[model samples]
Target: MIPLLFENLSIENQPVSMPLPNGITLTIKREDKNHRFVSGNKLRKLKYNIAQALTEGKDTILTFGGAYSNHIAATAAAGQAMGLKTIGVIRGDELATKIDVNPTLKFAKMCGMDFLFVSRSDYRYKHTPEFLEDLQKRYGSSVYIAPEGGTNTLAVKGCEEILTPNDAVFDVICTAVGTGGTISGLINASAPHQTVIGFPALKGEFLNKVINNYTNKTNWHLVHDYHFGGYAKVNEDLVTFLNVFNKNTHIPLDPIYVGKMIFAIFALANKGYFEPNTKILAIHTGGLQGIEGFNKERIKKHKSILDYEEKI
Candidate 1:
């Protein structure tokens, strides 16, 4: 059944006029409309991963993510739908705390995923052989390991399908760079005449190295100035942008990743980054359900201000 979803899916040509705050127009690809694989960029990445696991005769899959990770939820759903077992290695030691279990984690549990808690110190070594060996010892050796955020060579190969049906010419293809897997795949799949722009949603140079490590070509560029205070962090400007973007485009973008990337793309295009006639394709990686707990957490954390605000 899971394989059928991949076979029956078609990448919809989501067309929209992306307007910047400064009054510039850019054409955007609305990948969020492709809802077969939980919508957007994740669907493409998971297609190949799931297929590979099946091909290898692996019945169980293990991956890493944070408490609010969309990757975790998607993996669980994909596993259940495909008749495979899913294990999530969550970061941090607060897994037992009820308040720490966000909506994404809750849904992951409902999807029948087994959860394992790890310390922050150990999370840094998630990709190490020793850590994987321990997991194998516990969960059996048939389990396939997927890197955090599904950012690996195989993940990139899956993402390459994002541009397969593109008969239209594009000047730039833009996407949010988390582990850099999507952007790396975009670069690999893009026509030699096209350019790929990646917006880093996290601060620091970590993603730069990730991209460099996976990709050898230089057609892709990473922009780091518009993270909106790092991953999962948002402000009034971001909220305002998201509200307007959804109202205008009818596409809901999670503030942490896709929203930041869209925000940066518009900001850059407004500054004349592209020729007036250049077409830009922006990939929307879906994580809308992840926002349910995020907003609740924000309100709880800022109870003082939220209590006095006009009840919407």
Candidate 2:
């Protein structure tokens, strides 16, 4: 029998409140604090992938991600907890002599994941058949491959569990789009009374194509303006917002993806895009460990001293 490490996830309905700028109240499902996986989204995406690996009689799993990818860390943890061997195909070739360990990578190593670094050019071809064949030859045929971010049809099916059925009507469902898996799944699971809004964390028009290719739904729209500088990049406003958000809600949102999404949601709501009484559920996709690399001083100089306070 496959181990049932993920069956006891706690579901907490996050608070709904009005924002300062526009006064439109939004309901947020803060799945980021679901468990040690750091987010409900991670749990949802990884649950079935791990199950499929074991069911198919595969003892090893191969996947792709950046050095700081939450998916990589989650995969490593899940693999270790589930008795499956894990290999992380990292983008970039600088893993050997890294001066400082990014927290995510450090945790992934602690989970017993083997890392293989590839060039940027080669990393782009990760989903190709040649890459899979090479990995199979290197790791043997017992390895099952999960796409980067665990964004697959099965992953989407897993994410549907995050949405709870409600009698109340909602106009829009918003989420940060990274690999487009969660948002695509949201689009699939949402009712016709709601429209799914995706805030893309990457550049270019490729996300639209990715979403379209995965699902035929036309109600989903991608907002490309609020990445705050691409994936893993941070700006002053985002940092300030993150700090204030953490202070107020005690919910830590990683500045790369979730932070940007929340920022965009506030911005759009303030601009009067959302009608009065329109319910908005912002899915907090989690990557809390990724926040370790952020320089608190550069973002909030006045409050940097708080970082030194001993936790009680």
Candidate 3:
């Protein structure tokens, strides 16, 4: 059996830059700093899944993702570190020849991940029986399929470990929702007195159902107004906010997940949404590896890039 690196990680709370209403205390749980590549929720999500694979005698882990997916990058890195093979079924077939230009794919390739590029239309059927059967036939039965965004029963179980006894002091636990796995785990683990709030990075009402499938806890709610536009969508205000927030706090936020979540938290704070003296803890789900790809797109459009790096 392969051991996980830094399996018992100590996540710290960094106070958000001061000057807030009602004297509310806001701190971010730095889950992003958990690992170099397989950081944040990815580390937590993949922990037990990889263990299960090893126990089942699986030699390869196959997963699905888009061009700039953090899940794809993290899965590859974790598989490499664990001495297992990694295969990424990328969403866009056009990205096959562009791997060198795509930062996320490039990094995954560097970690020894093989690619199976598929068309967007075909990728939509990733969960369908026919598509899954094709994958099993192609990769052989020895491969364990990790769902897109790395959300599964085991993934949620792993995410449940994100919060410890020390987190009970927080009145509100917050995290960015991708496939709702992380938030679901948080919901199940949260104290009855605590409320779990998820800020989605995409536009949709479907996540409520996705989350419900894993947890029966009623203390969680989703805020849908802060996605900017949709998944992987961004605007100038968000970019500026990320740069300025990092400048003030010296904590780098990936533009995709944590950046949007932190932005929404501040917006809610400014709107007098949080109660007086409420202690809010936001989980920083890492995807900083995608920053290079994001900046590349921004540079092509002659726009400002994310100014912070993980080293900060």
Over 4 Å off in model 1, which ranges?
A: 18-24, 99-101, 165-167, 303-312
How much does candidate 3 score in TM-score?
Answer: 0.97
Local accuracy by lDDT, each model: 0.76, 0.76, 0.91
Highest-scoring model, lDDT:
3
Where is the poorest 10-residue window by lDDT in model 3? 1-10
* TM-score against native, each model: 0.89, 0.90, 0.97
What is candidate 3's lDDT per residue for 55-91, written digit by digit as tens? 9999999999999999999999999898989999999
Model 2 earns a TM-score of 0.90
The candidate with the higher TM-score, 1 or 2, is 2
Instruction: Return the lDDT, model 1, position 203.
Output: 88
Tens-digit per-residue lDDT, 47-93, candidate 1 = 88888888888998899999888788888888888888999999986
| Candidate 1 residue pairs in backbone clash | none
Give the winner by TM-score.
Answer: 3
Candidate 3 all-Cα RMSD: 1.3
